[model samples]
Target: MHSNRRINVDPAKIHCYIRELDRSLLRLAKSSTSIKSLTFIDSELKRVEQCIVRAARESGNLVASRFGGILEISSKGSKTGKDLVTDVDRASQNLIANIMSETCPGHVLLGEEDPPDKKQEASDWMWIVDPIDGTTNYVNSSNIYAISIAALYKGETVAAAIWIPWPNDDGFELMHARKGHGTWIGDSKLHVHPENETGVPATGILSSFPRWMPKAFNINKQLMENQGEIRNGGSACYEQFMVAKGSMQYAITGVASTWDFAAGILLINEAGGKVMRLNSDGLFENFNGWAENYKPDPQTYERLRKWRGLILSGPPRTVDFVAANLSLKQPRLFTRIKMLFNN
Candidate 1:
């Protein structure tokens, strides 16, 4: 009778156990990339995606809990004191790192808050994280902040997840994707807007203006006058995620790093949009390759820590149009003097 008696189970505990099982399967899949086993690959991708969702949720919750409260503000860069790092940022990163470690043991962790201290090995299977993609926005009490995570296997991104801290309820907004699988927000899949059939070109674009890259201001102004409108949300992840979701025609910025745009790059690709970096010849080339087979030596890695140039993302035609219209040549001394006098 003791053995035959029915036993009650906590549904929450069962859910947690299932989540663990998914994470384990995902780790197995990530470890066996060379085999190209479709079954394992698919299953593992799903699992990595699950881990991403879980991490994003937990991190977002922590952010929400601390919102509107007094935060410990700090700085990272020396001399300039331009870049800001807050206690919330560190706490959020720590939360994500801890959660990911619990889910996938032995997987390498690389985060913006705490980057890899030692040389990055070629075989490193990495989870790249940006605990708060829009730190300034969060500090200013804006809703554009988000948590981003991506899984890199041999330098290729196989899965990514980003969570927007919004509504202050219902678990926030989420966007995610896998290499072959489509991108999605909540339960709905995302797609780039169809090309305008009426023949009139898209008038507006989304863009960024880093304080360090003021030279691009002239071109950005030109885009605003020629195009219908220009917008800067102060959040790199939000801009790219919006592009992938068809809310923006394209995104332009002076420069970006892996953590700033890695997750959203996959989203745009999987959503049938394009991402490119301008070349010296004034032609657009796929910068997506930067995320693949990336084993840079310390010097090279430091150099690539932040790249400078035109970064654009959108439908092919729109991106090409913007690239061609914007003048790539830096203003001559005379031109700069004339502009300053005119202003």
Candidate 2:
């Protein structure tokens, strides 16, 4: 983690959490329902967060052993070339779902590795679970990987968590967000950093493992040369978690999935940063949305417009400056989205 803010647990954590909840509700009034439902959502989320950490870490280590081995993988859609679903993915997602159901029977579960069951999609409150955010990484043991979970109510992410098993020089991170109560890393709650900007103060991107990609290749070369530091240990959930803590300026993954970033997008946003599509050039910003659709329409566009391959970062001026220097392409929706984003 690139952050200097150390965690010191006080009895006040609960009091502060409650006070913030009240204030957030008072401010929301009738504008949003996120306040009204967060209490129930937050409780269930805490349960999920606690139980998933060890399981997710174990799953990552379990999946990493057969490195460079042929994958027992298959494609999801008959016609789609890259939409793969694997045996490890199925087993892992099922493991998370089953554990969650046993631990939190009332909550719902939705995952990327399998077809949605009516039981999950129909529930009032649902948990979006990406058993393994980086499945390809699992196939090759290219990078360790992550498990992301976000609890949603009425299609808005009231609470979200991203867990990465292993951390680089930065240790493993756990990021949780509860509506307007703000974000947290382990026990330390985070605030909107009015001063810190992404990719500065330290290198923007933090890879859990260094050389996961390009072990010395082009993307790696450009990132190290331009971004400042490179680490690639394992796990997107932890990487994004560190960024939310301001331990890392940005968390980058060459390839990401709906589950990989869906919860992360919501998590970082709650922490006051943003996640956007990496280098997409589309008329509509890729919401990277799921069946959960746990965000407002505006939130989707904002996420994509802000993304540079799921960069968990903040400070618009700094992002633009970095994107420009990297020669990243602006989206077709960039012009329309700019007025809404720029003050």
Candidate 3:
């Protein structure tokens, strides 16, 4: 039987624990030297990248095959009842999980749909997956949905793969990256557009912001005035893919979970871009990495699942420019008092 007891491994000792694991399969350096550790990590990440790319491709095909078919959909029990899950989403995740079990067995698998019950399985590495990222778009027969898969080592994303549908039913495009390796689409490496002389896009650039944020904040207007144009492709992963390829300048998402951006964050970072998130100070701060406060316990999955925040990602200069121009609306007196009391 799988134990429910928490395994409290100190974050600082995680590397030591990893070194003691099956070294032949993991290829982790047994040495304490930082150089050797980094080298081993890179080598392992390369293997992880290959595994996830295959998983993403298979899941993508599964999603595409059911794109227009009748799907059994249900609400995720959100307040608005708009958040949805479908049969295809569960099937896609199952397929990805099966592939991971074969290629990288014993690693923890976390998916947007039904996470694993064995929290003790989360050892040194965990796979974060979003089998169908744009579920609403997929439900509506839109081609903007994507499959995202990423591997996190000691809470830091080390490898990622995102599969997006190609236009005209031309199969899918797989964008993948490993830490210290450049992001790639097929054989070509991706580089974000260079900062223009004005520290912005030369002409209007394709960009995205949450459609509903305009009602509560002026971020939409600020983006339009400073960034020139705006568009929301209904899929955060798709928008992030565009940014990684230099086709879009930036994208700002309202309240997103880890699975929504895990793969894209690494993709953008590897493509010479940056990601920022709205902090408690009401400022957009650079997102350095994930799992900074991770606890290796049964509750860790819940902590990650509950993780939600606003995100802005793009080329560093453009991201800074947009962050500078954006501001939140001041709360009303009652709202401020309520917030203070709640805090």
lDDT of 2: 0.55
Model 1 TM-score (2 dp): 0.75
Lowest lDDT 10-residue stretch of candidate 1: 334-343
| Candidate order by decreasing TM-score | 3, 1, 2
Off by over 4 Å in 1: 1-36, 79-81, 115-124, 168-171, 197-201, 204-226, 280-282, 291-310, 331-343
lDDT of each: 0.70, 0.55, 0.80
lDDT at 130, model 3: 90
Identify the superior model by TM-score, candidate 2 or candidate 3. 3
Cα deviation of 82 in candidate 2 (Å)?
Answer: 5.3
lDDT of 1 by residue, 67-137 (tens): 77899877677744356778988898898888778887766666778643545433345677888887878
Top candidate, metric lDDT: 3
**Model 2 CA deviation exceeding 4 Å by range:** 1-71, 75-85, 116-122, 167-174, 180-185, 188-239, 245-247, 251-257, 276-312, 315-317, 320-343
lDDT comparison, 2 vs 3, better candidate: 3
TM-score of every candidate: 0.75, 0.54, 0.82
Give the 10-residue window scoring lowest on summed lDDT in candidate 2: 279-288
